[model samples]
Target chain A: MTDHIDQDRPGRGDGAAGDAHRAKPTSSAFEIILPALGERPAFEVGEAVSVRDRSPIGHYRVPIYLRGHVGTVVRIIEPVLVDNEAEGYGRNAGSRLHYYRVAFPLTELWSRYEGAPGDELHVEIFETWLERAQ
Target chain B: MTSVHTDHHDHDHDHAAIEQVDRPGYYEVMETAIRELLIAKGLISAGDIRHQIEVLDSRSPALGAAVVARAWTDPDFKRRLLADGRKGCEELGISFYDDTQLIVLENTSEVHNLIVCTLCSCYPRPVLGLPPDWYKLKPYRARAVSEPRKVLAEFGTHLPDDVEIRVSDSTAAVRYLVLPLRPEGTDDWSPDELAAIVTRDAMIGVIPVTIGGEAA
Candidate 1:
């Protein structure tokens, strides 16, 4: 099979551009989770979690603007086979991570928001990027 | 199962497209060079790569639509889908080879859902096929996260002021599938009949499923 594609579909690279983010490592030290691996997840459904405000210098999944923002946990997703931080360096530590979908109010995320007051942004964030909301 | 690698032999599906679109771009050139080097070094075989592409090409939105239609007509299946997405898909004979977890977000009268991959177009490919061209554009990605209502408006998906809109950014390994609310006045429709109207856009939450016979 040839690698050529119809230029008419310029954005049809199968998400290859996004692969860079998955391959890079975060500058900040890996965040720690309570109970580590063989125990219960740190956050529960509907629990509030504050995304850590720390800025990492390398590839990471957590959106920068959402850092330090508070959101309610929607669900505790499956375990991450390799922590993204380690994956950036082409290392597979085989570390299990608790993933959570946190829903943040649009108003809280933007200063001049004009959408519905109840509008929210739900993102799948790794457990390390979250801290118990005050 | 004990062999080094088992032959799939599921070549019954057509591969005409694979033979037609063989033009190699710069990335393809690079990829081919790398793959050739690896093959020369006895690292990986060309057959492995071909098999992988064939597997991917076989996937399409039709698979996801089938799952959605089943959910619409069967309450038991709907419950299973909402509770566990990946398993629910498996129960319907849909399985993903990758480790990415599939999460189905159901839209309702009070709440609306939209899927975007702001970081990159990390889409649910095993079910809904490749992400559309518009989905990967930077404008769509940026505006979808910062100004989703406006983005939806452009897609002609205008929700009432009362309904809350939620945008899900697929930033991690978890892939999202928007389970759009079933259209009204279709209670007696068959699964295959209902699946016909479930478009790729509807599954992505960019548009709503139509009640009449309008094709998506």
Candidate 2:
């Protein structure tokens, strides 16, 4: 599929040249680390992994959805460091290790889920909440 | 057998009593704890918190409805919207957070975009208000990235199979809001009438707006 890079220049297509003026170089550390952390080694599907609860912060990416859900390890992503929630509370200052692509069975999550037995929801989780599932 | 049965009934009654041990309900306990902390720290007055809740509870759906209506009538304004989402909204007098950035995604024939925080539920609350309960589910987050079409399907939304689904994962730095395609028909309709058809789900790209039973 051809990707159209919409030129921010005004009078090209639309008269408003405001987007061009506001277009800044995207060189933030988050974008830089995202790519690196996205390319981690792969793991086999259905492998078990223990999931645990994480400390709360003012803002967090770990939604309340998978707070206590147990899931299988599906893939291992490149390690990325993010703001530590406990540390953000003025406790210990450190970056937390996290992985991407862990899969959980639909039935394991909700008893009434009627999807196929093999249907799984794969999610990214932090290292602290994971262990080798028995 | 009679002595054993009597002992079992006594044990069951004791268990029931233990289970019934009085404890504050979840919402009450949480509210109390948070209130206590805030009061102890003097961060805000109780009256202030109550007033904030009152304001939040009193918010009507009119503001969002107006924004949707205005965009439908003004082609020039839509151009501005396609360019700068926040600034365009400001032009319509809809003020959002000055601190955070909101990115708007447009739906086209080739690709469809959906937003999910995956890790946590991060919503454009200032514009959209409270998020639906399903939005906070782990299943929604995990499925949104892997199988967006399926997740949307649960919300009674279906796109052409050939269309590529692009799911935007919101983080601390950026937030996303979807802009659905305009519905067909109602060419002669006024802006107010157009806005009436533009639901919040349409703005979030979960559903397309329809005009006079025609797809936008």
Candidate DockQ values, in order, are 0.54, 0.08
Candidates' C-alpha lDDT: 0.81, 0.59
Q: Which digits, one per residue and each the tens of the lDDT, describe model 2 over residues A71-131? A: 7765444334453554456764345344545666556766765434544454555565566
lDDT of 1 at B90: 89
Give model 2's docking category.
incorrect
Worst 10 residues of 2 chain A by lDDT: A31-40
**RMSD, every candidate, angstroms:** 16.4, 15.3
Give, for candidate 1 chain A, the lowest lDDT window spanning 10 residues: A5-14
Residue A66 in candidate 2, Cα distance off native in Å: 16
True contacts kept of each: 0.79, 0.10
Which parts of model 2 have CA positions greater than 4 angstroms off?
Answer: A1-134, B1-22, B25-31, B58-61, B212-216
Write model 1 residue lDDT over A1-134, tens digit each, in one string.
34222122212112343344334543533321112242356677888889999977887898787999999998888644456666777875655667888999999999898898999999989877898899
Candidate 1 lDDT tens digits, B79-107 = 98988888899898887887678889899
Give the per-residue Cα lDDT of candidate 1 at A58: 82
